[model samples]
Target: MVPSIRFALRGATLLAAVSGMVAATMPASAKAPFRDLNHNGKRDGYENPDLAVDRRLDDLIRRMTLEEKVALMLHGTLQAEGGRGIGAGKAYDKASAQELLSRGVNSFITRLGPDPRTFAQENNAIQKLAEATRLGIPATISTDPRNHFAVTAGASSETGGFSQWPETLGMAAIGDEALVERFGKLVAAEYRAVGIQMALSPQADLFTEPRWPRGVATFGADPATVSRLAGAYVRGFQGSADGLVKSGVATVVKHWVGYGAEPEGFDGHNYYGRIAKLDNESFAQHVAAFDGALAAKSAGVMPTYVIAEGVTIDGKPVPQVGAGFSKPMIEGLLRGTKKFGGIVISDWAITNTCPEQCMAPTAEKPQGYAIAMPWGVEDLAEEDRYAMGANAGIDQFGGVDNPAPLLAAVKAGKVPLARVNEAARRVLRLKFDLGLFDNPYVDEDEAARVVGSAATQAEADTAQRAAQVLLENKDGLVPLSAGKKVWLSGVSADAAKAAGLILVDSPELADVAIVRVATPHEMLHPHHFFGSRQHEGRLDFRAEDEATKAVMAAAAKVPTVVAVDLDRPAVLTLLKDKATALYGLFGASDAVLLDLVTGKAKSQGKLPFELPSSTKAVEEQHPGRPDDSANPLYKRGDGIVLP
Candidate 1:
């Protein structure tokens, strides 16, 4: 006799809760029956009894109708309609949320404010809304990478919550997989405490080029290193348990296929052309990291907006004139070849930018552009976004404004029913695997206690130690005396507002000025392609440069230290000559730097990529080129010792 659906669900929930209790009681080393055993990384295949759960999930999914299934595939973010605010605002209040749910919205992603209590309260409110709905479909709250330092907005801002750790690239420089895993585990614990079930992070993208602003979020350039770190991170964040609890929030390994290989080191910029003779090896290496993630059974994969060569769907290339809707690339490469059975998510607003003709409007038309003057393409329409993304096997739509159109399209028979069911099944399976149905809530009091707790603080401290990469410390130039009346300059330091050597009111102040440079790609107008060697202008020096020079001249009177905050290494010729000492702080926090300078913590990070001396050098050893012999700068792995 077939088991009752409700009975099976109750049993599943009980089993999951019991497993959580067991995990709390058992020692970390003791092997419980529900502990994940495939050891291949992800929770794929029927290796252990957990396979029974998969069958039950399939049974549950099979019972759902086409409309209900389609609803499950739509995941909504709290981003405002005009991109002005986060979370459901006055315009999108609980009533609006209820309306969306009535129209078939299946999932919701909420942000955590800086205050842990506030975050919990907001989450509880959202959860209450979900419970009030007819289907009782649980809301899955996801936050930005909040493990260390708050990235998007300040903690006081509505979008902020959780202590920020060092950037992922900084973590990679430590070269400690164990440390990476620990970071993930701590992040997971915080998420669990807050009732957040999914973390849209551990950006598995490789940092092939230093100039990419987002590179700081990646592990490093090496595929193997990224893969190992990514896998370990998945294991750490997702927990090693089979039943649930003490297990990790589901890990969403992101920027799915190819994203890290943007030309000229900028994200969401020009796609690498087929004829550009780009570094295919570097591009291929990105897949290696995803392979690691897949092996670990990362809960989800996110695709990027960049187009890759020879990657197409239905004979159409991707991210090009008319290719954002490519099917083969999404289904064949990501799901088929990678054997990824998890959900596939598109990057923010990517689907909206689909279709060849869609363009985002701009004020002016630049030279050498193919499209009309000043008009930007809106890649994919909202309706087309759902149809194309779902048909292409995308399990969920992230950051989508109004999912009503998508649902209406499905109801009108515009989208295929089978496609909807397939994507929905994956989403349900993940929720089930996460044990969301059984333990859908988190302890609000416990959340406040656990977030940034002593244990998490310790882990953050460890991450700080691992993330410090000393770019240059010539002849023991570092470890400066704490009490010395040192001159510090730069927007970052000046923002601190301490007394020292002062320069002009601008960034050019100090006994030492730390200048933050723009990413290389941002330096160019949108029209310039990768091969353009035109150095139309010299590097723009900020007031900070003048201040840095003044400080260096005054260095004879008093010692000076120049701190450089960078995503990649760029030559500051002024620093080469004027400063008493220069140090490169690649996205390290103020506290981390303070600890390093004051000897509170040791700087142990190493360079994860090469630092170019000049734009000329960058042009010579262009990222798209096959050879690296032409560049003159610090080779990969070049860094100074702080001790």
Candidate 2:
């Protein structure tokens, strides 16, 4: 047994030894304090003498006051803004962090950046802040899906220290649970090395619709598939061999119940068709994945900005109130029905709904005074966030600028003091479970050794290899002869930068630039998920595509090979009709692509989703429905014949 487990066992044995005589004389039906021992504040284990740690937790909870319980729920991320980046900018610093912790802030979320050494440094800085605090509340460094390609700005930099894998969709295409688990384990190790105690990732939201810009972040459409993969991911991330980081870094299974069925694939912008409205059966199907995640002991749950229609709060419908601040869903559904004992985190900047945009600065509205807005109107004030979110049982506030409002609310009797204590206690318990109190500092040298280590790079390579889907390979279009003057066509295909397959430090060394074809990120216009949809957001194909086709038509004069970066595979059908020889590539690194074409590596990937022949085919399918066989241009699981 691991030392931690053994230590726990010994501690339990000693306690039992002290109570043995009293226990033997007790009646059979009488309950013993041994039933609850660890005092971790969570009901984790059963009534067994062998399981003393469980008892200790029960004992701890029993001793905790209602105020302390409230403290356990008040988790706060140190950063103020919500974007795809690491570290809070000028808004928050070490001094502010110290001040917050001293004022009773229990949880702190930090970003994991591209560089491992930077992460260690940032963590060390936070450690000092924790040490300076009166409560000695250890901060939990939280990352936003850093395992894959770092999407956020500051997160992409090496200063935060994280390993980069393929996008989540790439992992889903691999369909290898064990590999996914391995990825999670590596990420956990990197996190542990950097003083990080929580991983708010393994985004389990199923990508029911492709139109959703964030769809690439999801595992895919199937709940069973997501469940198995997400469970493995959680197990790998939380479970540890030494029990040091075991319960590995606490996993936060996110966006809670239903975020996959969003209308028009918008992130949280549209709520019309987003919820899982089916009866208990359908709800079960969607929630089954979360069951697997919870079974893995996910330490946190984040509710989205969008609300379920039928779900209500104080006799009011959910959409009327921001879902993040809703009481019924968080308290009733998540905590009450699901029995989730972990922290409840609100989405970034979800507390500041008054100003329309999250990051925008605005004036506070009067109490109980509703205002008109494009999304909706409500008596929603910054102070209202605390009352509604806390009363609703939210334990943490993420991506917020000022927690002073929440603290002020507590002082003003807007929020119950008991609730604050509950939130804090829960945060403290998680820190204790993570062993952060014992050793909060991260070793920069050790971080360098582990973050982006050779093993992690190998995992990335493996993931990249598995994510490469061959959409179409017509008449031996691939496996080109090494000496042939292969003419690459299309803007994205021509420029290594646009291809996104190559991890280039410099763009000049690129092999060639065909004409331009828009990448999926460019084609779909990511901002549309926020509500804006204009042709400008569409692919700059008029100029770029025409140039690409002209070059490809010219390249057809020679023994040329045309490869298109298949972000949205539909582009390939257009390219296929024009090129003499064509091959579809999905997010492969340039090196990987070169190897495949040069016959150095074998292409093993199959399509995870169907490539429609046209946009019309896509429009015909139900927005969030997965079964699209009725009008699928090309069936899913289709792969090209490679020579």
Candidate 3:
């Protein structure tokens, strides 16, 4: 680390050099102010694009009031009118423009994505509204992963017109740093084209426990591999291997610490599934997985919703609070140990009210309305939670709109105003660095032209084709001739026909059969919102299961090819033994799979996480460890080329 004095000296020298260049190039009469952000008809330091980020941040924070700072720290959600863009001449909220203009809420996570042009328009409207405020602090709009096939409500979304690539694990399967970087660049471009400035993505959490519902969103089970891929992901999104740049999308590398180590493989999104078992030694490995992302200078980091059950730092038991609220987790670990100086944003709904519906739901009254993820701080008062979190290094609250609790806490000396000012500075610095204040509006035509263009789609198509891992190909069963009669399940008949395979009514009358199956899951808890949608529970295919039955019956009569969507690695023992050919899929489409089957494409990816031999193996393995099962069907890095 550079000494404060030396850093200051360097800054002064750079400023002198830059000022000399400007003076030498421009005449006094020709010079014009960069921006009139406050509409005062004069230039402010924050409004000047040429100023250093720190100088601009200092200027901006100095001008902000306590209420404005509190409101700025709250990362709210925006709703698009008609589910496309904000209503014309109106705030995204139903509130009047005067109400919005009075506050300093300048950052938001948008769920209003219908198309590229509409998304750009909505963001432009928000920026235009911000310009009318006392200080024209442009809003930094963020979104979850959208350039993918997976469309989990809170996790990832489908690309409306953006290039669709594999899930993060699929990128891990390919395991090419360059390829993942390319994919990230495309995602970054698509996001910026639509005026989205920040990306709440590139989850660096290791795929430790296979049954963890969010395993698919992660890079597979090795710290070194996860680190490499995570770094590439950040480099691509931020448009630099070194740090965040003006043209890049700010990447929030997420679920910090031990999120993937779900005890009993239950997700942390629910009350009953908040604990993640990580012994002192194993905890280090989990933290090490984020090294790559951190090294690449990820613009932000979001702490996990789960609590680390058995973690300690420097012989002290780490507080068993959600990472976002734990001083030990954030201030002590992330800041003191990892030295991440970027913005620390809390995961969604950390300060929300966990009503009866959210806490406990039955078959009839499922968890719906009041979604809360306060985890270890469930019983704390709202103001206490905010005070604890803001002091613990959380800069912003996700999924929260009202800033009254935080403001009250700050006013009553529960949370320090200094911490609030620091948080506000970080937020404003990011916006300034992204050049949002200069020009937040994107051309609608440019957005429409750039997003999901044929070139990007072609690139995505190739990635989809390469993400499939070949495991078993018996007796030249794969690369099946296009003229063969084929029976299909979980695969579209139209896709099979397009591959020139003659569709057969049943396996008995076909020369071959193509089947695609999701790694089987049980809806043990139908009450919770995430629990109902999550692919949870046993990773083995039982005989009575419909997908298993379909594969069995089809293989009974003809040579069957099976493709398992390994959202989480499945125990493929039975199918690998019975089917003539088998492949592992991350986010491949039916068309991509069919093309591979007909010799138009080839498998280029390897197994990302280990494929367990049985459900017993999955149960016996440690939640915090990776690829350590006693016996596995195929280990990580295992693959076969279908000839």
Candidate 4:
């Protein structure tokens, strides 16, 4: 027998609710086989799972207070210590989270321990707290990209026993939209297993600036390629054709518009984010990358921490403020023209008044001496900042816990109650569509079963091999014969042997020299470790840097193969002429690299972005444009197919 729960609702009820009230209809006896606690015989509008989502959402919003409505628009990070919530050194127990839920917050971001069981267990605890609330509003848990191999503080979390994959740029190297989509499906299943409903990713920003610190997270520089893959990625996460289903993870296509082009190649933490000379056509191409995603119905968007410079909206220049605070940009461009109605969340802490905490601060350098990133609204009061963002069409503020400021804005007449209700409606509507209220918990054993299964790892392995771009194989030096005596650097002795080659310590004793080197950058400090990941300013190597000198010295000795990890493009002009072979890697382990070199797998990847010949080319290119570097060393899509 087909389940009655699957039965569709029929009536003029939704139309009546749209007119602002749902009149009750009572049957003599209920056959719904569940509680109609309000005892109307027919379920109440809010309680009826059968009602249309719009009617149910209206029922809830009309019942909420100005404070509760405002509370629904704020998201904060919940820190956990030993399975217990911790905030401000208080016992912030589950009871405390339950209390907070009653006051109303439906979204949270958190990092869990590297154990899948612990992640599932802790998530269930939080969900139980939400279930006990007055309205039983299910909390949507969000997380940064956590399935990558590398874990940098504040940016990415380590794969907590989840299926590991290469960096997003590496996937772009493979140049296969279907593979990227498959990866998306695998990531979504793992996320749902652990109760993570939203992914703050597929970073839709173009990697036009090779030196931007966060370039590694992007899907490379070509708008067409990135656009195709971005759409596929969204479809992979949020189920295709039919919107987001239970197995899918809601995608928040991010850094809305453009965030990749930070002026002077600095990270977009402050005024350095002001982009210049951005014309209409260039703006269209940069945004083309997100076109597929927006068309695919991405559930949310996040504005970057930078201000877009010189953009005209409605025949006037856009206000030079952060994207979150600019009404012309958010309301005019994204909301009106782009036609996106999903939740619009500000990048973390955009509303904070204190400079020290607002700027990217490190544990070592706790006092943030760098300029705070309130952008154009630096002079506005905290309540006014919240008011401006809210009125400008931002649906929620990220990384803020308190609801007092927004509530104050409403009371001060700076923001209307209707606007607050509008934001609340969007947030609650998404929760209902995700079906979070029905089943928010996970089965601990099932989570362990699906997270890092062997099948997922095999796909990652195949992707790693597919992602290796063979840029140069001079004199047929690649696919080196298996029995060759090899002098390897940057790879361990056992790893060399695993590739079935004799390991020689000195270049003099070997038939050929194979050296693996990373694209080097000058280190800057006294900031957050995640900030350190950003390769600011010059993307070059001097003749005398110790690491560069050593790698060159290896090339100087014998026939050499240079494997460059293109985390950001390396200035390899000096090494290009000397090496017998060259390769570009996005992100892969030693084994994957060895397999490509030793003919275990064929090279199928290509350059996702241009590799500039000099830092001057990088500096001269327009930050807001795509594929615009001056005289790049290698053009986009450059790769050698093996004969």
Give the Å shift of residue 64 in candidate 3: 1.1
Top-scoring candidate (TM-score):
3
How many angstroms is residue 133 displaced in model 2 relative to the true structure, after the best TM-score fit? 1.5
User: Model 2: runs farther than 4 Å from truth?
Assistant: 1-92, 112-114, 153-161, 240-247, 269-285, 309-320, 356-378, 407-418, 489-555, 558-572, 579-586, 627-630, 640-643
lDDT of 2 at 195: 70
Ordered by TM-score, highest first, the candidates read 3, 4, 1, 2
The lowest-lDDT stretch of 10 consecutive residues in candidate 4 is 1-10
Predicted candidate 4 versus true structure: per-residue lDDT over 125-227, tens digit per residue: 8886665454556789888888775565445766778887888888888878889889999989899888889888878887776777777888988888788
Worst lDDT run of 10 residues, candidate 1, spans 1-10
Displacement of residue 240 (Cα, Å) in model 2 is 5.9
Residue 488 of candidate 2: its Cα lDDT?
A: 44
Model 3 misplaced regions, further than 4 Å: 1-34, 82-102
lDDT, candidates in the order shown: 0.56, 0.55, 0.83, 0.75
State which candidate, 2 or 3, has the greater TM-score.
3
**Worst-scoring 10-residue span by lDDT in model 3:** 1-10
What's the true lDDT of residue 176 in model 2? 82
Leading candidate by lDDT: 3
lDDT by residue (1-643, candidate 1, tens digit) is 1111111111234445655665666676654443222122222233233456667566556555555566666666554323333453322255555555554564766653546665666666666555444344557767667654324331112324465677776777777888877778887887877777887766787765445555566777777778888887887888752212335788777766556555555445332221111334555566777776778778877766565554444354444321224466567777777777777865554444322222322235322222211102244455765676666667777656455556667877778777777777778777666666545667778878878888667667667755665655555555654443344444355433342223344322432333333322233434432213222222322335554455455554544555665455555554555444555565556556656655567777776666656666655554432224245355556666554
Candidate 2 lDDT, tens digit per residue, 3-56?
Answer: 111111113355456456556666766534432233232223422334444453
Q: After aligning candidate 2 to the native by TM-score, how far in Å is the CA of 197 from where it should be?
A: 2.0
TM-score, candidate 3, is 0.92
Model 1, clash count?
Answer: 30
